[model samples]
Target: MRYLVDLGWLRSGLSFSFGEYFDPENTAFGVMRVCNDDLVAGGKGFGPHPHSDMEIVTVVLRGQVKHEDNLGNAEVTKEGQVQRMSAGSGIIHAEYNASESEELQFLQLWFMPRARGGAPSYETSSYEPSQMVNHLLPVVSHTGSEQVASINQDLTIYLSRLERGNELSFHQEAGRRVFLFVIEGELEVSGHVMETRDTARIQNEPHLQLAAKEDTKYMLIDLP
Candidate 1:
């Protein structure tokens, strides 16, 4: 992981190359391109930017995020909310903290679309924090349900909170990949211990066993 601090107001822990940070050896994982854990000071954020053929997802972890886009979409997403934007052909958007005195923490992820040159679109969905207790709540998926944001990719993003001593299991089809990120607290994934902000990239593992060492909140992505 790489740490990024921008202008004293934005701090980020990046899992893949983004912005001015580039690592040829660690560029991307499957179709997933960027995973940035960002903490922005109140009233600060990125200005309007352009993107094309990218599946962008944002999960607000604390405070609120104000999103504005050239597609005439403007909204505020609070904690537990998920936002997805498909920059199919092209799109321009900006994100900022909604509060003037509160810090905002969120995870911004980018994925390569299955095919490019479609119409751009945006959507938001939310789940109650209680719904994730010891359960993997699907927040984003290609086949989206009412409570899940749809994206132009063959992947599903799940959020979960596990209490100490609680365990969870996942099984995937053969030849698929798994990406795990610890958002808070600690967990023992398979056999490796992961603390806050640690990530695990797995392939050829059809089954995974996770146990919480402490009360933990995490995000897991099943990628093709």
Candidate 2:
């Protein structure tokens, strides 16, 4: 991952090439293009920016995010809240920290849509931390269910918090992909150890066994 410390306000660990970071060999993973672990100082953030034919999802880990767009959508998303914005044809938006005294930490993910050229849209889904205790809580999906935020891709995103010594497992059909990101603490996946902010990209693996070495918070994405 490429880490960027910018202007004393934004610090990011980017899993793929984005903004001023470029890596030809680490450009994208299947339909998932960008995964940025970002921490923004209070009262600071990205100014107005434009996007097109991309699906942007923000998972707020701490503090809050104040989001606004040209589509007349404005919302404050708190911790454990997942926000999705489809920049179908085109959209301009801004994201700022809602608290002036606390820093904001979030994961910014970008995915390529199956098809392009549609009206822009935005949505948010809230989840209780208790629901994620030792379980994979589906927070974003393509199913359009009321329980999760809908995305324009054939994928699902899960968030989980596992106590030390606990275990979790996931199974998917053959030929699928799994992307795992550790938000905090330590974990062991299929014999490989991962610490905080670590990422794993797995393919051709139908089943995964995860063991928490410490109280761990993580995000996993099942993708086509």
Please tell me which predicted candidate would have the highest lDDT against the true structure.
1
Model 2 Cα lDDT, one tens digit per residue, 1-224: 55565768988898898878887888889999999999999999989999999999999989999999999999999887899999999999999999997999999999999789978999999888899999999999998677699999999999999999999989967878899999999999989999999999999878799999999999999998
* Highest-scoring model, TM-score: 1
Model 1 clashing residue pairs (backbone): none
Give the CA lDDT, 0 to 100, for residue 121 in model 2. 96
Model 2 misplaced regions, further than 4 Å:
none
lDDT per residue, candidate 1, 1-224, as tens digits? 56565667898988998778877988889999999999999999999999999999999999999999999999999988999999999999999999999999999999999999989999999888899999999999999988899999999999999999999999977878899999999999889999999998999877799999999999999999
Q: What is the lDDT, from 0 to 100, of the residue 74 in candidate 2?
A: 95
Q: Estimate each model's TM-score.
A: 0.97, 0.97
Predictions in order: lDDT: 0.93, 0.92
Shift of residue 46 alpha carbon in model 1, Å? 0.8
Total backbone collisions for each predicted model: 0, 0
